[model samples]
Target: MAYFDQMGCKKRKRGERVFKFKTFGEQGHPVEFKGSFRQNVKSLLAFGNLGNSLCGGLASWSFQLEVHRNPPEHILLFVVEEPIEVSLNRHCKHCLHVGWGNHMICNKKYHFLVSSKETVATCFGYYEGNCNESYSGTAGKFNLVEFQGHVMHGVFHSNGFGHLLCINGVEMGSDLAGYQIMEFWDRLCTGLQARKVSLTDNSRKRSMDLRLLYGVAYSEPWFGRWGYKFGRGSFGVTQQMYRKAIQAIQNIPLCLLAQQFGNSSHDIPSMFSRYQTLSGHFLITLRDLLRFMLELKACLPSENGSIDTYHSGVLVDTTCRWSPKRVEMATRVIVEALKKAEFRWVSRQEVRDAARAYIGDTGLLDFVLKSLGNHVVGNYLVHRCLNPVTKVLEYCLEDISNGFFPSQEGSVTNDSELRTRYKITRAQLLKDMFCLYSHFLQEQKSMMNTGIFATTSLASRVILNSKYLIKEYCGKLPSLIQVGLGENSDVYCTIRVSHDGEVDEGRRKVIVPHECFMLRNNTTFNELMLEAEKSFKEIYFGLRNFSIKSIANLNAEGTDLVFKVVKVGGELVFEGSAGENGLNDEDVLEGFRRDSVVDCPCGAKYDDGERMVSCDVCEVWQHTWCVGIPDAAEIPSIYVCGRCEKDILEFPSLP
Candidate 1:
């Protein structure tokens, strides 16, 4: 009988089948059959031929098979490709022999043979006999082989098309199932170097390319599948993994194009240029800020020396203290000197010398000191007189020199109480004397150049101008007319012409002798003028005292004289005398009484019979009678009366 298979093909071929039979004998010898021949022997011979092919020729086939008494109710065929083969060797009697291809043989009887495709070497089925010693009688039909260090199992199957094997028994249709098998084979063949396989050696590489092409071709379905697995709802499960994968891909090198040719020098120059530009701009801005701060410091009011507790105390109780304006002026002078030395075009040493000379000149120093008691700059004024050299002693010398003095418009009330409280230093008094001499010279010059005066007026103007210039430039003035004057008194004189170029009738006249007296007076005039000039030089350069007696004896014959005397207390007493004889006691006494009534020493008021005593240090006045002193035979030349003497001793000198 012939059977029909599922593909509509006859399972047997008539008259073409052959059969061969064999029987086992002792020692595995072939034995002839004892049964008689049947009429259907060709069918039996065909079955025997099929069985022989299954046992021997099937060893080279890439398929696994199993024979059972009953066929399986359901059959599933799988296809696989195998690159390596395993077979049993029949040369050994007691042992199963294994070799590649058809060289394998076995001693024990086996009912089935298993084979697999070169690509699909893994298979699974049931076996009835142990064909090889290592194969159990009931083993699963599969080929197990070791390649490198990894073990690979293969299985084969028969489908309608042909026999196929499953590598590692993995289903080929499953996702990544093909990759799994190829990776296993790859690991076995190459070990770690398998990852470096190129297209030449790796069929998997071609497969991977085909898969990628297919994925792109069916992008919709693949993307749909991917989205279903890793959509927004599923992102929590794979976000970190996906991000890592992207980062790895980005870090991987795609080509070596950049290594061969890359331009970085172009960027380097630009980067450095930008950095230098920004750095230079920053430095310039910093310099400008420093300059601005320095200029600001210049504009602020500053003081010399740090403020100490004493300075703070004086500032707080300013009414009895020297005004801050004086201190500020001193500070300005110091600061200006420093600035000139530092910034002026002139040499520093030259600037320093000029500053010192300007400050040291008695006339200029006196003007600055006097301006301390008046507003000479800005909104501030010095309301109290300060001793520039002593620093501590101050005075309110408010007796304004009214007749022939440097004048400004404003008047300040004399603070008698303050004057009594403060005393001027000797240096300050000398400075004031120098300033006054300059003022007198200025007045005499104005008088002489007016030219409205006659011979006498001209003479007087010339005399006054000469005397004042001598005193100012050489630093002293002399007195010619004196019968009696205080020990500390020095006379300064200024003679002015009448507006009509004549001696005014209303003015007091000086008596003069006729004829011979005039000649003698001319001689006296020459001698006294010379002596006055000499005395100026002695006082200025030698620092000597200009005595009233020495100046009075300059002329022996009669001469007209006008005297303005500064008593020890800085008071001015004026007297005029034109004389053939020297001033009589009565004239001297009368002039003294008139000037002395208002405290001839300091222009301070005196109580009845309160004779003023003069300070030898500053030549200023205090009341002798009020100070509890009896009259002395003569006022001591070096006597600073008690109060001023005490003040001088107490006040410290400037550094």
Candidate 2:
């Protein structure tokens, strides 16, 4: 029957076709059996020469092949057998649920037949789904293999929530679901609400907390899939969480908000509540703002963003929410109010720039004149009085000075009041202020040609120039007038003019016949002149109308005597004088003099009333008739003196 079957002879009708194949080989020969006719044909083709090789003393092996049904042409086959892998990928719609059982239960792996397909299903006491029918299987089809425990490949699927809870390449159990992540976010928000911490608080601890929450929500996991659904996006979830938190914060009451924000414990709630109650009535009037400015309670708006506590006290927050331009306008309003009160302060920055401009590279005076034109620099002087420094004694002086507040303008109504208030007269203040500025400007003026930027003014330049000229003139002024009086009411004094050339021994002191200059307590020029004239008459008897010229010589130009006097130790002394207009009680006079005197070696003072002659040899004066010249025309410009002629051998030597 086998040989006939091999020859394709059908003696009896068979329900199914069968094919058998055998192969022979040498030592260690391979034996193969075909289970179907297709496999038998493949086996026959694989083993060549099956005709005599089966019995040719070769290694022979025989096996039976059977097939109950025909095989499909191109059957689907698995690269691996038994299909133990469980993929929880979204494409496969599979998920894993882990369950733990008691230690006493033996570990096992079970295979289930579902719709004639095999899949791995392990049982503890729990399962993920409640639908038992979806996974139901007959007991006879279950196969138990050795089990290690929960060691298998499959990840959780979040069901309706998509793959949000799924982490690719990570086999997590389905029990850790997306709902748990959402619950975590909710709890955080609730905690924030219960604590009532202000979101705007810049405190260190609050800032740290916010940063920590933000960091945890946005930080990506090392091994998880970066998905977009549900709680998978760390950043997205964090944003949603903060949005809900902000909503919660907004729902808080205004009173509660203040209470939480205020860092004080005493009466803050009451005080804040009062403000809240009257918030509708709080009015910002011009007068109120002006008062605040005058009181120095607020400063001008600054360019650098900084909150003003003064404004905050007035229920105006200077936070970044307000525009800078609006804040600046408000600041200017306060400044205008300050100006109304006559309170001004120098800005060092502008002052420095003006100073630099005044002290330029070439001409310091020119620079100062230019700087005076600057609007900010022009009004620097305030009645020529500025406080240089402050001290205890200084405050006392300031108070005393304030009492003597001079009339702002026009004539003073009450002389007594003016005198009492201002112990120092206006003239004195003006003189002192001029001197101060003069010294200040001189010191600040740079002499070096270096063109470093500096600031100065025109008033300063005039002061400096005048100061130098006055100093130079003072050094050469004649010492005619005496200063300080003796205990006696009358004191003896000598007056003299400045000598431009050599002085004669006889004329070193101009003999004033008035030895006594009456030192009256009052400083009056009329009294002094009378006293001088009386002395002159005493010296030259019967001489009438003798005039006292301050700067007069027979040949030099003449000017009137305008005296400059200084009192020292209760004595009045004449320093020097420029002219009437140059007179200042505090100013030291300069370049003043009496008439120049001419004297000859002949022991006689020369005057225009006297007949005088000069010797060409010695340049000396002589009486025209006394020198043996009978007539004035007989005097010679080249005449030789007797003494000089004898020395020159022009006459006989005296024995």
Candidate 3:
């Protein structure tokens, strides 16, 4: 016979008959056999006695294998520490433990027999649905030794309840085989602290099936005969339950982690370490739940119309009224939180300044003030000089005044007709109103301490200058007329009056005839002369005449060169020329002869065949038609020439 060890078979012999035997050992460690087969076999069988004695009546045994063969045979042996009941059953003569022997029947020897106490578990049946069939099991018993180990005792409770059954010492059960091995280990560790460990292979699979139900119920509560129920304050029990389930999963080793670190059978240390971090995983899940709750709350309807669930909770009536006060409150809360957080705080003044800057020159402050209505804040601002309404009014009036009547000259004449037509008074009421409002704003609270009024004044001056230029060229009238000016019209002329009551007419003096001067007609020559004289006097009121060294006559005829003779140094002197080129020219002499047939100054006949007559003195002939003369028949006498007549008058004694 050959002694069987944990590894395989070992050679053995007795006396003259050689025997082969096989042996088994604990956990696969080889057991050494000494001496003959009968001696070692007896010793190996006695090894169970030592375990039984040490366990104090609790059954214990050792695994042993022996094999017998022909001459020159080999003996195989194996040893293991097991319960005494397994050893007794294997050696009992009348027991059906023949399969537990280490000897092979033919060429093959028995590897090892599973102790009767080892549990045998296998998948029985699976349910079909949305749930994973790998997780579900049916009520039925089946031989499972091929899958795991042999079953010791099995029984089905009443009505398929309490299906608990113990197997051999090995922890093989349906719970262990129901799900993947990794998942099985995961669920095994979840409720480990409660001492309610489920060693069955179906533990993980059953939990997974339960989790599927949880998921389905969470999504469609009515599908599982459950009514819809929202959680208090936006957090629901279903969400919590889901979180718990995830937490349970995290308690197990992640498949990737396990594959990397665990061994083929079991790796308790690494699994324990992974399970220790379950609290952190739970915290992460909690954070995710909180985020989900916040998102849900944000999407929920508040003061707005109820949400329409028909289209997956879309808001149909979007015309919801939001409370400004509530919005402000919420904003304040957020701001406070932000301030308290690890960041900087933004001041209210800074925000206001930012808003003001954003508005730029749009005058939004005025708009805000105007829209404030009769609120307490509005009233307070009005009392405190911070009133935007008053400020806008002041700005508007100032703009109008500065943009209309600008200079004293243009202001008086522009829009004179419109002023009259509209029956408007030229009083500075608009300007005064703006000034009073500005004064009120400044004196009440001094909101602008940097002399904004001065800036306004400067801007007003610029505007006034611009308006004056526009009125001057375009002939547009000012909004208001001056006191003495007529209505705005083209007939009006702007005349500047000096401190001495003299008017300025550009390079000359000009006096206003009357406010209604443009309304008059049929002016006489005397009246024209008097008006011209008055205009000149008014224009050159205090101007002194420039000293003239000599007076030169321009190319003109007749009295065009009138002489004002004066004896500056006791001498007879004429300031102008004589004869036709001077004051006493032929043209002047011709005016004196009404009907006289005067010869031309070039000594030509009055009636020349070529429409031209010759002058006798200067010898220059000009045609009567060319000279614009009416008729020669209108002359009384044709006697003296033009130049001869002038010479006779200039020097009468010599003539």
What TM-score, over all chains together, does every model reach? 0.12, 0.13, 0.12
After superposition, which runs of candidate 2 have C-alpha atoms over 4 Å from their true positions?
Answer: 1-571, 574-610, 650-655
Using TM-score as the measure, what is the rank order of every candidate, best first?
A: 2, 1, 3
Q: Score candidate 1 by TM-score against the native.
A: 0.12
lDDT of 3 by residue, 185-286 (tens): 222112111111111111112112222222222331111222212111001113344344333322322333233234545442232221111111111221
Measured with C-alpha atoms, the lDDT of residue 564 in candidate 2 is: 32
Q: How many clashing residue pairs, candidate 2?
A: 14
Q: What is the C-alpha RMSD of each candidate to the true structure, in Å?
A: 67.8, 57.9, 60.6
> lDDT values of the candidates?
0.25, 0.25, 0.24
The candidate, 2 or 3, that scores higher on TM-score is: 2
Supply the TM-score for candidate 2: 0.13
Weakest ten-residue segment in model 3 by summed lDDT? 466-475
Candidate 3 segments exceeding 4 Å error = 1-117, 120-208, 211-655
Q: Candidate 1 local accuracy as lDDT?
A: 0.25
